[model samples]
Target: MKKIQFNLTFFLVVTAAACSNRYQTNNHTAANKADTVQSKYINQPLVSHIYTADPSAHVFNNRIYIYPSHDTATGAPGNEQGDHFDMMDYHVFSMDGVGSKVTDHGVALSLKDIPWAGRQLWAPDAAYANGKYYLYFPAKNKQDIFQIGVAVSDKPEGPFKAAAEPIKNSFSMDPAVFADDDGSHYMYFGGISGGQLQRWDNNVYHADATNKYGEELAVLPRMARLGKDMLSFAEPVKEIKIVDKNGNLFKAKDNDKRFFEAAWVHKYKGRYYFSYSTGDTHNICYAIGDNPYGPFTYQGIILHPVEGWTNHHSIVQFKNKWYLFYHDVQLSGHTHLRNIKVTELTYNADGTIVPIKAMK
Candidate 1:
């Protein structure tokens, strides 16, 4: 009886193993089919009609909301002249489901609405915190000096009011906001020579200006901690750099500066990923890193300029699936009137992101 029982248990175990293998194989097959369908859909030209660019998107309540720089006239090509900046506006779009094509909702915020907003209101990033939706955008004053401003509304589609005066002492727009699991908030902005992070303290900052550039300069991509009230920083600023440009690691060029702008940082599965646009903004490239303050190694190109000069991008994940949200100027003819586009992002075994083809 004991021998018979042992043989029976062994047979049951073998059957279970076989069944598990079959289940995994079937699961993989189904996933591959879904991917093929998605690839076909993404390959289609998404924003062939309108000229919109500098996209910032967030997933809220199972829907994705995108805010992009909008062209004033429908079917009108963007004006690239310095004076053309005044024609730009901020428009919001939403989809009922994640990864769905965004439908235009007219204008959410416009340059004419803000009392002090200059002719050009550039890249805008939005976040939902507490009970309010906050938008951080770059606009010029009557003097035409560019500055960052904040607006608040109760809903994503909002008649948002300017919450505070334009943030002083910062340049190189494209502002992004990140709230960590610990309830701390950080704002990342600036461009090639303008990136920096600040701690929030009730919609205000103490303004730390101790870097080599001095206090008045707004350095791009600098990381700092936020205080309890969510308006100011709690620590000294740490400058983040890419690995290819790092003197300690690669020794590429002391001043050969590879562009790193439009930074979006997220911590996932014990690794912090910092994605930024590299090279020229018109010929934008992409790289990733494990640390927020890098040594960020070049992964590969996410989207290359198809009909235009460069690509500005943002990455967000919803429901365990990752999507790359970005803007391109195919229709606007290399002007700043960039249209928003979306594509699914896949990862390699070593955690590198797969390069996506530019939509035709």
Candidate 2:
């Protein structure tokens, strides 16, 4: 009887050990599957041949399309003149498969169409709304006056045509358009000092300039509501201040304070995220705010001065994943050879963006 009992006890122990091993293996398999799912959702740009700068992208019909400031076949960058000074041009690139890789489709638009524009053209932003695609760009007049212009196309890849004359009397460049869920449209643009808020009117707004140059005299970081059509502002302009040079709360004439330019605002998970570059364009900085027109608080610098001198960025959500789109001087060098790069954006629990590391 004792020998029989020993044999049974040993068999039971062996069976329990085998079951434990099976459970451990299953757990590891599940963990690996989760990691794979997370990685697949994180979108990064695939390699491409074109060297472009100040890229603005919009995803539609399950494909991502990018438009950037023009670069000549000789690999020369455009917009040498002041903002709104150039005959605006842009190159079109598309991802092959959904999230596959970027390919240059060649020139989407050029200045020859707009005979009136001067020689300098700078940043460009594109968006799809109301069954049409719009490209917003800056161009100069014969008198060297800077203004924002719009081009519209039936499809994403476009021989876009100027919808109307340059929105006259607006100075700060880099025009970005955001259509809110409530059907209101807003256009944001500015540089160094701060950006402006204007209602989008197919025609232009005629307002007296508070400054000498006829530029809006208001401080940097401003916003205005747009009319239903997304062309003009709805209300008077309001200013947004994020941080000072000392990284404190913003105040007038704070030598250290920085305002918004290359500004983009998005609503995520019921919160508004406004991200803008600070310091100098060459040294891109960032900040965040709960409100669109913010009394925003400075989070920190996103991209510091590195191989390239300047950085201007945009953020987008594709396939439920967030990405940072910006230009870096990696291969192009000090010639400001800006090329578009896409990277994963991680977030903190406190609702701030994780700082980006400088490229090696």
Candidate 3:
């Protein structure tokens, strides 16, 4: 009787394992199917079918394309550890020509295709330069520490191919790339708590050092000049430090602009606007400077927190109108999964953006 019981329990365990594998396979298959059916919607909260957030928008070849991260619960086997962001893929959305249909170019990149990535993807940015479209993303490695990677494609909406490895001197995440009018390329990146920053030195591909508070770098967001290849840094000393409203900058808990993450920089009417999600993670604030690298004075909030604890945005002027793309948690019923929202961002007479509430 004891032997019979042991064999029956063994059979049950094997069956459960097989069933679990089948479930995962089915879910992935369904996701693939959904990726192909690009739903059409014209409203706030751009995507509702699947949770999507962290929008990075740009005007490419007279059309607007958005690269956003996929939002999900910690994936597969289940998050027995509770809820956390679990983005394994990315999708690109575009409005081909001004009044044409909004196209969802599905699965621009996915972790299943990248061998080095530890199966986690985060906020990403894209740019068109030198006849190629580039996608910069921050993802974790097998060790669970996050680093940035770049992928390339001939088309704005891509079936992209990633480089063999990540960008050498990249650390943290939320990579925002900007191409200047003079054909120069720059990238803004980083995010951490208590104003501590981890960075890569020219001497070390991995960050062997930590930047402390009160330094020019700690309080400000960092931007590096990209090499012609767009994968390496060109100048070490020219890294940017974010400035504040009073010609000052953020510090480690010493100042009000304790910039948490989401570094977004855009130029408006010859003035560079440096915007970011402040620490409390609920506000998307801005500051204006004279150059791409800023000595900016704080302007004001472009987006205020609504229901979620984190906020991120991208600003773009499309078809002669400016729009702010950000995310919130109203649809998910919990903060772990989020949805993207869009609204018209208005500028004051003095060039500062009027504070706006996040919708949908």
Candidate 4:
């Protein structure tokens, strides 16, 4: 009787193992199918069928293209550490003009395709050069350190191919690339706290580093000119200095005006406009400078806070009208899950941007 019972127990265990394997395989197949499903929309909040945030809008071949981070329902609890934003893939959106239909080019890139990225594919920006479209993104490497990576595609909306590794000397998150009229391309990147900018104080990584408080010079974003190939940095990274109208560096206590993250550059009337988010304060602010690498003078806010805890954006001119592409949490009602939106940006004759109210 003991021998018969032992054999029956072994058979049951084998059956259970087989069933679990089958279940995992089926779930994997479903996820792959979902990744390729495409949707179209035209109204505000951009694409509603799926959650997207941190819009990086650009004009490619006269059409407006947006590269945004794909926000998923990761179920991780929200916190200052940003563990809740566990995005693993990206989607590209495009439209001919303001009221035209926007198409979702599904799954442009994913973590599985990236050799070095471990997780959290955050805000991304794109540039067109060298006869191809380059997508710049931030992801934590396998060692759990944040680094910027680049991918390329033949077309603007892409199923892009990532480089084998992250950019040399790249660190932190939110990478925005600006292609100057002179044919020079520069990348603006970095963020504080959870975005990991604090860790790289003085350009050296310190695991215990924290942002300075009141009166200490505010944390600055880093910029590097893209090499002629557009894949590497041409020079060592430099910190961008943003001063007040009186030419004084902002104190760390000036939360409303200091740079937190989301570096974007746009040229207007031959002057460089450097804009960024005031992280915890939740405002989109800008500064003006004579050149791309600045001593930018803080002007004022471009956008007031939206419903979410974070705000990120990009400014671009499509068909001669400038628009701001940004995101808020109106759709999911959750901070980590957000929807992208675009509104007309007005500039005064003096080049100061008229602050616009965010639409719910």
Task: Tell me, by lDDT, which candidate is best.
Answer: 4
Which of the predicted structures, 3 or 4, would earn the higher TM-score when compared with the native?
4
Off-target runs (Cα >4 Å) in candidate 2 are 1-48, 72-88, 96-99, 193-219, 243-257, 279-283
* Residue pairs with backbone overlap in model 3: 219-250, 220-242, 245-298
The clash numbers for all candidates, in the given order, read 23, 20, 3, 0
**Candidate 4's residue-wise lDDT over 244-359, tens digit each?**
98999888899999999999999999999999999999999999999999999999999998877999999999878999999987677788889998889999999999998775
Q: Against the true structure, what is each candidate's TM-score? A: 0.70, 0.70, 0.78, 0.87
Residue 208 lDDT in candidate 2: 34
Cα error, residue 285 of model 4, in Å, equals: 0.4
TM-score, prediction 2: 0.70
lDDT, residue 204, candidate 1: 38
Worst 10 residues of 3 by lDDT: 194-203
Whole-model lDDT values for every prediction: 0.61, 0.60, 0.75, 0.91
Off by over 4 Å in 3: 1-43, 75-83, 96-101, 194-219, 237-239, 254-256
lDDT of 4: 0.91
lDDT per residue as tens, model 1, 243-293: 553333322132222444576766656566666665343334444555455
